[model samples]
Target: MTRNFNYWSQKGVKGPSPSPMFGNILSYFITPRPHLNMQWQKLYGKIYGVYNGNKPVLMVAEPELIKQICVKDFHIFSDRNTNRRIHPILSKHLVVETGDDWKRIRSIVTPTFSSSKMKKMYPMIRQCLDDFIVELDVYAKDKGDVNVKIMYGNYTMDVISRCAFATKTNSHKDPNDPFIINAQKVFAPKVSRALCFMLLPTFVLKAFNMRGIAEESANEFFFNITRHVMKTRSNSQKKYNDFIELLMNAQKSSTNNNTKDVNHYDENDSSEAHHVNEGEEEKQVENKILSSVDKYITEEEILAQSWVFFVAGYETTATTLTFASYELALNQDSQQRLYEEEEKQAENKILSSVDKYITEEEILAQSWVFFVAGYETTATTLTFASYELALNQDSQQRLYEEVMTAVDSKGEIDYDILARLPYLDAVISETLRLHSPAIILIRQASEDYKLGDTGITLKKGQQLEIPIYAVHHNEEFYEKPNDFIPNRFLPENRHNIKPYSYIPFGAGPRNCIGMRFALMEAKLALAQVIKRYRFFRSPNTDVPLLLNKSTILHSPKRINYPFGAGPRNCIGMRFGLMEAKLALAQVIRRYRFFQTPNTDVPLQLNVSLAIRTPKRVIIGIEKRL
Candidate 1:
């Protein structure tokens, strides 16, 4: 442990001195990671070291260095830092694979999220949003506190289930459904697997044959479910245009081609192969090459991919929605503008929408990775976007205007239209910048490499932490770094931003594979909700939104009960709560309220009635900015 502490110093690098055994864990535990990381960067400069229980991890935030590592020198940093003790089920996942394995699997899965494929899956997402809007309508009608996290979580889960497995689930209505319950457990495990992985030595964990990915039961549930779905789909005649079916088609195509090759021709007989189909064969070959990069993926890989989709798509996207709604609520003007954008678009056109591993333990690990990666990140993006929009109405209104203009004449948004909405895209980009789903990008050095002219040499096996949050907030990279400014992402201004500095989904070849899908999911939901209902601050709203990363569900917490207690509680409790909730939801969607010169700071009250009431009240209300 002492030797590990000296590891950085020996290489002439500067960092805070780590204490015995615990290293920087004490500080890490007490301080929030983003703040702590920013402090470290200030003190030790961009390139420094921090110890995670004597594991020397280099923190790199400098843009040029980051570009070199993530893009220019990607071959030397291809693999993510891992304990190499992955569960058997997850061992084969693309996220876990390195070098050739990663390349092969990535090629096979890349086409699954292509523009054409996203177009095919858009209707499924649209259907899910229709249900989502219904649920939101209930909230709007009842005027109750909204738990956007849980609401968006269910929506993303519905999307993943439908798109990944061709299975429709009522997650929006039945949050306790088995699919969600199991997926949630995988993400927020009952046990602190992350703590264990960070604190326990590999040898100690291996001695007990422990798997860190998920509870064995959850793994089994997904494994069995994925296999069953694949089996049932294979035997069925229905041509479902979902993710699993796509993989199955790839597998089937590969099998048929292999059989044909064995029976008819050798690899060298290109002429003979062409003769079989004539003119159309050339077009087919080109299409196949473009669409299906490789059809040689195995059943295990396909199953792993399915599991990953569930894990990855679930929470992240939901979190984004949660924050986006919260922001819209706080910034009523922005919410109104967004609503206008959607409404105007409605006047114009229609709305449309919208990974894997290997090993028994390895396969489970892949599923675990997918669920964790996809689920919360996108949701969190929407959540933060809402929160920021609520605070910054101008940005939201700009986004709305952009959305309105981008919609087709039918009032529908298709894949191409969604892609083209610059202002809408800017809002999401700025949202991602402010509340980046990923705090850091981890990479392990494959060989000894020199970092710039800083005289720092990264040894083989060194772990690199690209502090994304820090870089994003650095004033050098962004003006008024902390402020939410979606305009910065507009095409004309985007060129001014540094490359590798605004990486919410990372950069280079190994960046998040599900980025396109996540963006589409978030953009569609934002457009739909903003058009129909406006979000505004309520008494239950949390200002500045204290983020508890460990907690996935956001429920309103009320401290003061103005109506009194127990049997003496106000008779209008239910009616008041409903009236308040509904009024805020409906009114805020259309207008903005604030204090005026005529409004008294402390309104005169009449105590004659059973309940003290304001004698007279005055305030200003206006149409959305």
Candidate 2:
């Protein structure tokens, strides 16, 4: 234990002092994560060390160092932090996989959120958004305050279910829906449990078989549902375009021929081509496959990926929506401008838009990833957008105008029209900046590596964290970092910003794969919502917004862009943006949103797994005059 505590000191790394068995864990618990991180950076400079129990973590914030770690020297830091003690259901997915395994899974999953796939999946997302509007209508008619968080959660859940598995829950109308209940449980705060996973010895945790961050029942629920979906789909003759089908298709392609291109191009696909290895031969095991050569994913891996997507997409997207709306609500000028733009140019309707073969477990996992990743993040984007628009009315109105100006001569809204709107893009980017869903980007050293020109050396297996929120808020990187300024992201002003300084989804090879999908979903939702309604603060609304104590990250995070950076960036970034734009366009075109007595002035937030989401965002809405 003494040796463990002396690890950082021996290396001559500067950091806050650790005490006893808890190390710096106690300090972490008492101080807000964002504030504490800032203090550490100010005190120890860009690179510092901290202990989570006796395990040392090197915190990196310098852009140059970050660039090297995430891009130039990626091979040495290819994997994110992970706990082997996590349940198999959670450990096998793309988010947790390491080294070659991660590379292979990523290759197989990259195409799943291709622009073409997102385009095809738009209708499914639109249908879900349409349901979302209907749900909002109840409050719009009563002139009552609506809770955007809960509402967006339902909408995102529906989108994931529909788009991922071709299943419909209409969660917006049925809050008690089993899927919603289970998903909520999966994201429910488990601070103590998570702490244990961080502090306890790996052997102790393995002996106890700790489930890590999620509830066993919820994990089982998702697993069982995924399995059932896979079975039902496999037994049927019907061909459907969804995530499960795509994963199945991947399986067929893999099993049929190992020599097939892992990064094969589809003429219909619009996403960037994934890098291909010329002559790497892949070997396949009976149930498990490694890298793109083998081109096979096990049932457990599939299930794990699905679980990650669900948890990843669900809260993150929904949280983005929540904050966007909150900000827009507080700034009615932005909201009105966005609304007018939508009314003048956006079409009357918002547009919305996958297939495959293979094992019941494999099928289920694919379906799960779609639902998990697709649903929450998109919904969260909408929720945050609504919140932001309510706060920053001018930005909202500007976005609305962009939406309106982009409409076709016949006032028809389509993927192309929405995709091209710059202000809408700026508004959503700004929203993500101020309240990025991902608080930090994590990496682990693969070998003994020395800091750039610095005497400090990181031993192999050292845990590293890039303080995303801290960097985003650094005064050096962003002027008035706490202010909600969309102009910083505008095409004209974007060049003023620096690279590796704005990572919401993350950067490098291990960045979020669903980024494009999440952003598209967010932009679509924000466009539609701004067009139809204008969000305003209500009595319940938190005027200044107070951060939750237990949340992992806090403070205002600003960035010039929102879709991550470097080689790993967000694959679904385009799709997520499209979805968000479509939704925003559709909503703002028809309704006006404003603050009601019940709105939470300084929105109350809570941590849901990896996302920091509002408990509720109550705002008044009315049909556009």
Top candidate on TM-score is 2
Q: For candidate 2, lDDT tens digit of each residue in 389-477?
A: 76666766666666666555654467755655556666677667776655566777889998799787788888888877677788898
TM-score of each: 0.78, 0.87
Candidate 1 C-alpha lDDT tens digits along 460-525: 988888776678789888999877666677567766877667765555556555655676677677
Total clashes in model 1, counting residue pairs 3 or more apart in sequence or in different chains: 83
Cα error, residue 512 of model 1, in Å, equals 1.3
**Global local distance difference test of model 2:** 0.63
Each model's lDDT: 0.53, 0.63
- Tell me the lDDT of model 2 at 457: 78
Q: Pick the candidate with the highest lDDT.
A: 2
